[model samples]
Target: MTAKQELKKSIIASVWFMFLTFPIMVIKVNTVTHTIDWRWHNMALVGIGSFFLSMLWRYLLKKKEEGGKKDKKAGLSFIQRLLQEKQFALPGILIITLITILFPHIFSMYQTNIMTSALIFVVLGLGLNIVIGLAGLLVLGYAAFFAVGAYSYALLNLHYGVGFWIALPIGGILAALFGILLGYPVLRLRGDYLAIVTLGFGEIIRLVLENWNEFSFGPSGIKNIPKPGFFGIEMSMQTTTIYVFYIVVLLVVFTIFVINRLKNSRIGRAWVALKDDEIASQAMGIDKAKTKLRAFALGATWAGMAGVVFAAKTTFINPASFTLWESVIILCTVVLGGMGSIAGVIAGALLLILLPEYMRDFGEFRMITFGAVLILMMIFRPGGMIEDVRKTYKFEK
Candidate 1:
């Protein structure tokens, strides 16, 4: 499109946004004085911002379209080629490793804590990556399994004095069992139907936790939970914060390793097959029941582990923390990051979590900007920030 045409479209968008935002941003009411105030500046700001943003959006959309055409002609993208070749991959890996080791030392305790939370989501995103990205299963109740893990640790420690070490694996196992429980009856379902069932299942978990006073502490939540111990040594809050960062770092590495291995394994291929064509996979002698169960179980294991870490990190547990919104955020990470791509999910988690955090300084506009960013991303890049590069094999006859 010509610049003149683009300019007209942007102006139209700006007018529309100004009109839409006028009722909320431009109008303010005072209860005590029973008076009304008009904020014209807010309206002007919205108009200007929308005008510039629309232009940027169109420019990005055009660039993406052009780049897609070029990439198709070039076969493998540069990043994909680097991934396939080991020599180029090592230096990148080493640099990232060095950064990971120095992150806590370079940042503040608050920053480290925030990063730990993001890493927890990185693990969560990976877990969901298996279900949604790999097996093409829509799991709306993922945070339900997350709740299972957090509660597993909380109740175990509160009742029997079980430590973090013992509770970690237990959390994973329990979450896996929950995953199986969810996957069993839904084995035959697909698409929207599967999503609805999972959504209902998630609500069930949340409602049960909310009402089950005798079991889950009835939404009052459990608190004063202990952090992980290191060789029976007691550490200060700062030290413990750093320790938790490293622990989550290790978990992220472990999650990536295991997930990468799973992506290349036989079952991994089975999952891809199931995702591509469930009926065809069933016809190809693949057991639909078993494969779906395995996907749910294995994918949920990571959520459970992350939940355990979450409980330890926050030293608290509540049904509110594992609500549907939390699950949505987790799902967004996988979807926004590029499903089936580890690096993408990690980047998504960091961007979604950390960016909003840093944006807190924007006050009320923080969420506004965040939501706008998401909308732009969905419009411009539906496949995610980094799409999963499919593996190709050559056959000789």
Candidate 2:
């Protein structure tokens, strides 16, 4: 589309979005007086911000398109080509690793904790990328598997005295089993219907955990969850944070490694094929049922691992923690980063998590800001912040 046409579309979308969200954005709950108040200033800011953001998006997109056309004709520059090559990338990876190792020492405890949380979501996002990004499946309830993993570890530790080491794999196995079970029933469904079923499945798991208080402790949740040990080493507050950070960093690295390997595997190619054209994939001799099942199982496996870490870190977990919103946020991370790009997933997780935490002073308006950012992202970069050029899918205009 031309720049002018894109700008016009952006303006229309901005206005429509403002109209739809005005009530929520403008109206505020008064906790002191138990009344509602209108924030006209906030509403005006949102309206103006959305318009400018839309225009900026159009401008950037036009530049990106033009750049792509130019690059095709002249090829890439030396620096660009070097960065794309593995020789440059490996040293860059080493530098990032060194920074991650020193992050806790450089930052405050609170900041370190936030980084830990972001890494957790990085793992979650990578896992979901397998299903949504690579396999092109719409799983609205991915957090269900995460909850299953957390609860598995929690209950096992509480009742059977299973430590983090044993419980971690067990939790992942259970979640994977649940993923396969969920996949079996929804094998015939696709797109919206599949999404609806998965969403319902997630809610069902949450409701079950909530109501089955005899086992799950219901809304009160499980507490006194054990922290992981360093081969039975004693853990202090500072040491615990360091341990969690290192463990999570390792998990994130492992996740990225596995995902990259999968992306290049025959199975990964089949997933992309299935994602792009299920009918054609079937005609090409791919087993649709098996492919989908593996995607679901593997995705749930990482979520399960993340759940274990979450439970250990917090030492508490409840059904409330595994809401649909969690799934949505993880999905957002995957989409915000380039869907199929591992680096993009990490960037998305860090940006989405840390950005909101740093903007906590905005209070409730921060969410509105976040929503606006997401809207802008979807409008201008539907392929995500980093586009995965290796794969292509049909896009509807």
Candidate 3:
């Protein structure tokens, strides 16, 4: 579309959004006086801001497209050229690594904790990436696996005095088993049917955790879960945050390494084939059942490990902690980052987690702003902030 047409469309959409959200934006509840106040100025600001921002975004997109065409005609852009050079790449990586290693020490404890949380989400996003991004599965109940992992560690520690390190692997194995169980019944399902089944499964897990008071401790949840140790040396409150930060960082790196390997392997190719066309994949000798099961298993394994870390870090977990909303947030991280891209998942997790904390001063309106940003992202860059260049599907000959 022409730039003019694009700008016009954006303006229209922004105006429509402004119209729909005006009441919510303008109206305020005064809990002190028990009265409603309408702030017309805030509504106007939102409307004007949306319109101008949309126009600016469209203009930038047009410029980028134009630049891309020119670059294709000529050669790689300067930035791309620099990236291709090993001399620049090695130093860049080293610098980034150094910064990452020192980040917890550099930042305040509160910020470090946030970074730790973001890293956990990064792990979760990477796991989901295997299922939805690589395997082309629509799993709406992914948090069920996360909860299973957390609870597994919690119960093991409570009953048998299992340490965090031992319980971590056990939790992951249990979650993988559950993933296979979920995969078995839903193997024949596809598209929306698969989504619905998975969503129901997530709810079923949560409900079980809630109602099974004797087994799970129900709504009250388990408390005082053991913290991870360094050579059995217990960490105090001040040091624990940094320790968890490093642990999560290590896990994130491991996750990225494993995912990168999987993405380039023979099984990965089969997954892409299955994702593109099941009939064609079967004709090409791909075992759909095994491939699907493996995807679910691996994905759940990462989430399960993350769950163990979460349980250890927080020292408490209840059914409320593993709600459908948690699944939605993790899914959002994947979708917002770029489904099949590891770098994108990391960036998306950081953005979603840190952005809210940065806007804490805005109080309730920060959520509104956050929602607006997501909507804009969907419209402008649905592929995510950093799209994966790799193909998610492979066509059969």
Candidate 4:
């Protein structure tokens, strides 16, 4: 590349990184407890600054391209070549780890709490991506499995006094069973019918929690849930043990690794085929029932793990938290962030969840503004802000 082109690329990349990192830093510091007095004003400036910087960068890049001044593609240096590969995600992961470790006290407890929540939702979004994106299943009651896992942890720990560690996998097993059970009955259903059935399933789970006071404790829900301990090491404010972050980080990594593996396996190919055309998949010797069930079970298991983290972090479980709206919002994350892309799903969840948290000062208008944005997203970028690596956006005019 020419020196000018190289300089422009470096500036644009640095500015884009700034756009991403600054908001996270500002949002982390602007919580309910550490509430900055001029929080909204600062946030507005951040939004405007980020907007102009990004626009200017884009404009410069486009103008250069339009000028027909072709810059030679530079051969990558050794380090640059390594980073240019798909394994760049590893270096990014290491950088995030270093940030969390080096500046542990950069955030307050509340900020840590919200970051933990974002991590959990990231897992949830990844799990849902398996079924809805790869397998093309329309599961409206994804939170039913989430409920199953949370309630399983709550009830197992509350009544039986089981430790958080043991109850997590148990919660997962129960959710898998529920998924298989649900999948068996709905394997023949498609589209709107399948959605309706899953919707009913979510409601059924919620209503069961409501009416079954004998065990579930009804609307009162369950409390005093135990926090997770790492290898017998207890996490507390004084201990300086970043167990929550570590546990969540490990689970997120594991989920991504496993999902990526599965997405490339034989079963994964079968799922894609089934999604594309059930009849053709069946013609190719893929068993529809088994493939569908596998997708459901895998997705449910991941969500169950997320539920374990959710329960531990909150230290309380309630039916109110796993409502229909929660399921819809999760779906929105998958939809708005490019379905089938794990990284995109995480980006989508972080954006959707954190945006509202930061905009709490807007009162009722916060939701109004959010709704308008969603409508615009659907109209203008229905495939999401980022297109899948395998897909391209084609505009019909």
Index of the highest-lDDT prediction: 1
Candidate 3, overall lDDT? 0.88
lDDT of 4: 0.79
Candidates by TM-score, descending order: 1, 3, 2, 4
Residue 262 displacement (Å), model 4: 0.9
Candidate 2 lDDT trough over 10 residues, lowest sum: 71-80
Instruction: Determine which window of 10 residues in candidate 1 has minimal summed lDDT.
Output: 71-80
Candidate 1: regions farther than 4 A off: 1-56, 71-82, 393-397
- Best of the candidates, TM-score: 1
Model 3 lDDT at residue 291:
97
For each of the candidates, the C-alpha root-mean-square deviation to the true structure, in angstroms, is 3.0, 6.2, 4.8, 11.8
Task: Give the distance in Å from residue 19's predicted Cα in candidate 1 to where it truly belongs.
Answer: 4.7
lDDT of 3 by residue, 152-235 (tens): 999999999998889889988999999999999999999899999999999999999999999999999999997888897867
Which digits, one per residue and each the tens of the lDDT, describe model 1 over residues 129-188?
A: 999999999888899999999999999999999999999999999999999999999998
Report every candidate's CA lDDT.
Answer: 0.92, 0.89, 0.88, 0.79
Between which residue pairs do clashes occur in model 2? none
TM-score against native, each model: 0.89, 0.84, 0.84, 0.75
Q: What is the lDDT of residue 188 in candidate 2?
A: 82
Tell me how far the alpha carbon of residue 96 in candidate 4 is from the true structure, in angstroms, after superposition: 2.7
